[model samples]
Target: MNRRRTPRSASAEELLSTLQHLTARARQEVGLHQARVELAQALQGKMLPAALPSFPGIRTAARYAPARDGLDIGGDWYDAFLLPDGALGLAIGDVQGHDVEAAAFMGQIRIAMRAVASTAADPGEVMARTNDLILSMDSSLFATSSFFRLDPATRELAGARAGHVAGVWATADGRSGITSDAGGLPLGIETGQRYPVTRRTLDVDGVFVLLTDGVIEGPSLSIGDGLEEVRRLVSAHTGATAEELADRVLRAAVLTGHEDDAAVLVLCHEVTPRDHG
Candidate 1:
């Protein structure tokens, strides 16, 4: 005797209903993920200082460019804070990696460096202390940083570098120069090694530009080419504000295919005489 076969179970209406439910769930999940990513980006934006402090007879502008990977929150950072004696503390640094971990490490080093710089008049001593602290904390972590103290009154800037790139100084007469030191190893490398500090006299209305290697180490261009590009862009926009010049440089870098994370801080000394009238 042949057994009667049972009819297949799922109905057209049932299949349609199931597909609709799955489609709705997928749309909901996509929306949630989008919101999460947007929130993360907002948080990263907040990590940077809301506004750079204003100083007497000085103008400052800065720009931070996240990488195209959307995880652009890297170890690169710039900070301007007040010292106890009213001298402004200016610094730019880049940790070895480029992720959330690097950003967190940058925050820690930034705070410690600020503290050391506030009390120590010598840029070398401040960097040495910061280096020692970073070294003593961990054996595997490393970073490169440059610390600078700008005296608006004297138009002088004293700075120390720990394997970071030398900043460029754009003179009022359209000449560009680099502030290069003998250079010391990056932080967390060798303890007790002294980093030398260099001093430069900035001209009135001159601009100093500090940047991370990300701005120079692109896949298409060599470091020298990047520097030349930066010089060209800055020289063309001599009348632009420090912030505007920084923005132009970074935009040009991206247009030229500098794919890594980028950061720039510019300080311009404006000639504003006291009101003796």
Candidate 2:
């Protein structure tokens, strides 16, 4: 008995054509992904401040690193500027998502917060005002933020939070711990929310470190462990300048290929003869 053989549905020529088409489509997809990544990074870079403001007795520094995965854009951002009242304004925040919309929302929020802070000069009020502004936008977005005002002349520090990660306060002798106060719901989540300000008289030689969650939540470590690692790294650089310290913290805590963007701000009040007197 002779058996009948089944014919192949796809010829060699057809298979080759299909493979070629798939290869071309793959290349197109890769190109599109690259363009998106580039655009996102550029938009984020423009949104963040190029340099932090400086003062006589206070040293300010900030660093932002884009995500090395996905779109290379995230909502992490930090800003420091001279307020109209002569108080240094510092803020670090992370918007809800890691898309282009999130990045654009972050820029608007940062600008709005700065404008509010320049006039209000109150950390709690600034956050509250920004919260109201975000609600007015009518977008499905929210953000966690820490807003602070520091008087370099008097070494007075005040801050408020909207469900953001706590900052680090390091003494002159290298001891450090989390510094956080009363916090309210994240901004844009609820209108007319109240954020209570926390005030502290930091030592003349103390440092206040503000950071986004990406800094304290490492790829392979828990937040607690990451905090400890940051403390250790910061302790080793107690004598470094604010900029140097910021760089060191990023180098030690954040890696090159982070899953999320990382942002940090460091404020240091150096003691002088007047402070001693």
Candidate 3:
């Protein structure tokens, strides 16, 4: 006897229903992912400085690179503005963490630091006050920052660092490095701790490069190596405009797998004098 024909494994209707369910799930997942990506993009755009301030006799350029694999924004930031007294304020800071919380904290710290600098004129005292403010908040939050007051007339830079990467001064002749003072811990570490200031009289036609750790502590490169790279790049591009040189250094850092948030600020003393009519 002919064996009963095996029932069809699945009716066309049943197969179609299963496929529809799977497609719906996939679409929902895709929609969620897209929303996340859009949100991240918006956040990243917001985190960066919308417009850098313009100062007389100063051409400032900044670049920020977020981690290649993660969110596009982090705690790295830069600020440059002319003080009321005609002195220029140059600053770079990194909040202790990443994301929205860190960005908010960075904004607050940067604002407070600038306010103090504008009024105090002493980099050390500004940093000290900033540290005190940070300490007053939750101890868990902290930041690493470097602030500099530039006097175009005097060609002097009064600087203070709070656990930030050191500032490098490179001249057409040679390269010199400046480090933060000892016992100057990162902000929010302790109240009443003093962050010492360092003063340097930059040579005319010299270039000062300040950057966040994202440029130095990159993968496949040590801090020293990264710094050396910066020195070399700056030296090679001595003839390049300050903005162009800044762009080159930032590009080099990004190429070298500096996946964290990165920022760079450069100050170059123009060799030519402006005609004051």
Clashes of each: 0, 0, 0
Candidate 1 structure quality by residue, lDDT tens digits, 67-142: 6654546777888877887777888888876567777777788888988997898888999999998877784768
Clashing pairs in 3: none
Give the TM-score ranking, best first.
2, 1, 3
What are the runs in model 2 whose C-alpha is more than 4 Å off? 1-26, 254-257, 273-277
lDDT of 3 by residue, 110-229 (tens): 778878887888888888998987777674778888888888778688888888887666666665454544437888777887777777775555677888888877667888888877
TM value for model 2: 0.87
Ranking by lDDT: 2, 1, 3
Error of 2 at 4 (Å): 4.4
Output the number of the lDDT-best candidate. Answer: 2
Leading candidate by TM-score = 2
The segments of candidate 1 whose C-alpha lies over 4 angstroms from its true place after superposition are: 1-36, 273-277
Residue 267 in candidate 3 has what lDDT? 79
TM-score of each: 0.84, 0.87, 0.83
| Candidate 1 weakest lDDT stretch, 10 residues | 268-277
